[model samples]
Target: MVTLMRKQFIIAVIVAALLAIAVTFGVKYAQQGPTLGGDFTLTYRAESFHFAEKAKPLNILYIGYAKCPDVCPMALSHTAQAIKEASEKERSKVQMIFISVDAANDTADAVATYAEQFNPAFIGLTGTKDQIDAAIKLFGASYMIEENKKSYLGYSIAHTDRLYFLDKKGRVRDMISSPRSSEEILQKIKELL
Candidate 1:
């Protein structure tokens, strides 16, 4: 009788452990936001500034102002790190496009510089208020201007700090709501590929 009780207890513990793992992964997967898709035009700042159709499937469109204080930096850093770690084949198929939501300060040139600073392969994008607004509306991203009057020439943008992932079809596949572990993002990129 004691042996049977012990066996039952062990089985219960195993089942509980499995359930816990499932719930943890389920929550993590649920946290991912919308995917990217549909037809949209965005200006990409590369060797020379130019407009391009998002006709590709595997793409990453990161929307953040160049002057973001914390979240933007962290997200960009992690993304760069993850891409750097991706295999050559994966890296070749993936394109990272950075879009600046700050119209006042982040010019196409400035945004380009910011993204290149992280990864030269990273493509920075900026455009007129109208253009940026269109992309924001299309993606349903949010941003607010926080004026820092106390400091000398101080102001910052509080914007959604999420990485928008797009599949090869130029559709949003998934959104990484926050900075993710490098390994996890690499795995996701592989899955997307």
Candidate 2:
């Protein structure tokens, strides 16, 4: 019995030490921030748009569908307001990217029209399931289309409401999850630019 107790104590100590090491590493990882976000290619204006090659020095990217009723429009409007508030010099260096997650209903033309409504310079993009999935993975964004026969649209999409802020090199520098006003967004843009 004594021997068994000793062995158990040793095992418990070993487990505790392992747990401590794991917690330390986890904290460090978080402190360093996420090592995600990158540029991705998709269809823009019925042509291939390589983000790294075509994007401006600063970019604001959002993932949603054109037919979205509330969240998407609100996000876009807020972003547009921010762009409009910026000086022409700042605006010249920045661009907005609207990526449609609802491929089933959002054709390239549809997304383009909707995106342009907010800001004529805003670039709308969408692609095949695989292409979109790859792009979404790069940004850690997600979306799902749900059937809602009872609703007028017959379906709805649940997606992340986030604006990814990218720097000149097409690297994600920050994310504006919910900006109280366009000024808040513009502030971030100015800082990054």
Candidate 3:
């Protein structure tokens, strides 16, 4: 009887230790922001584009579709204004990347054109479903494509409206959602710079 009680106690202790370890890792993960930025590659200008950490030094990433009528255009315009407001040195050290969540429709070239309309320095990227999904997971962003027969576009993507900021090491350092002003974005840019 004593042996049985002792074994139960030991099992409880082990379970408690496992739970503690899990909580520790969870907290660490929460502290560390998004991962897998360096390894993620998507198509840009008909070529595989990956972060040039030292070259760009900073990256502002926005995830949405080229066909997005409202949110994407405004957010990207706001981002462009913020970049324009930055000093030439600050602008040179940064690259704005638009990743199209609508992999099926937004081709690499199409995405590129969409981005350039806001700023010539801006870059746009798209990839196969799997590749886009990998990037989405890498940045901790989420999107859902829903078909709307009554809508003009036939389908619309409900995607994360946050702008993800990657530092010189290509690690996501911050994220801010839309409806944010140009001044707010510029402030974040200056802070990151």
TM-score against native, each model: 0.73, 0.82, 0.80
Q: Write the per-residue lDDT of candidate 3 for residues 1-193, one digit (tens) a residue.
A: 9999999999999999999999999999998744645447789878988766223677898999999988999899999999999999989878898999888888899999999999998999999999999987877789998988877999878998989888766678777888368898899989988
Superposed by TM-score, candidate 1 places the C-alpha of residue 93 at a distance from the truth, in angstroms, of: 0.4
* Order of candidate numbers by TM-score, starting with the best: 2, 3, 1
Residue 51 of candidate 2: its Cα lDDT?
Answer: 87
User: For model 3, what is the error of residue 8's alpha carbon versus the real structure, in angstroms, after optimal superposition?
Assistant: 25
Per-residue lDDT of model 2, residues 1-193, tens digit only: 9999999999999999999999999999989887667878899868998888887889999999999998889999999999999999999999999999987778889999899999999989999988999998888889888899976899999998999998756678899885457888999889988
Cα lDDT over the full model 1:
0.75
Following a full C-alpha superposition, what root-mean-square deviation does model 1 have from the true structure?
10.1
Q: Model 1 segments beyond 4 Å from truth? A: 1-36, 46-55, 151-153
Better of 1 and 3 by lDDT: 3
Off by over 4 Å in 3: 1-36, 52-55
What ranking of all candidate models by lDDT puts the best one first? Answer: 2, 3, 1
Q: How well does candidate 3 match the true structure in TM-score terms? A: 0.80
Each model's lDDT comes to 0.75, 0.89, 0.86
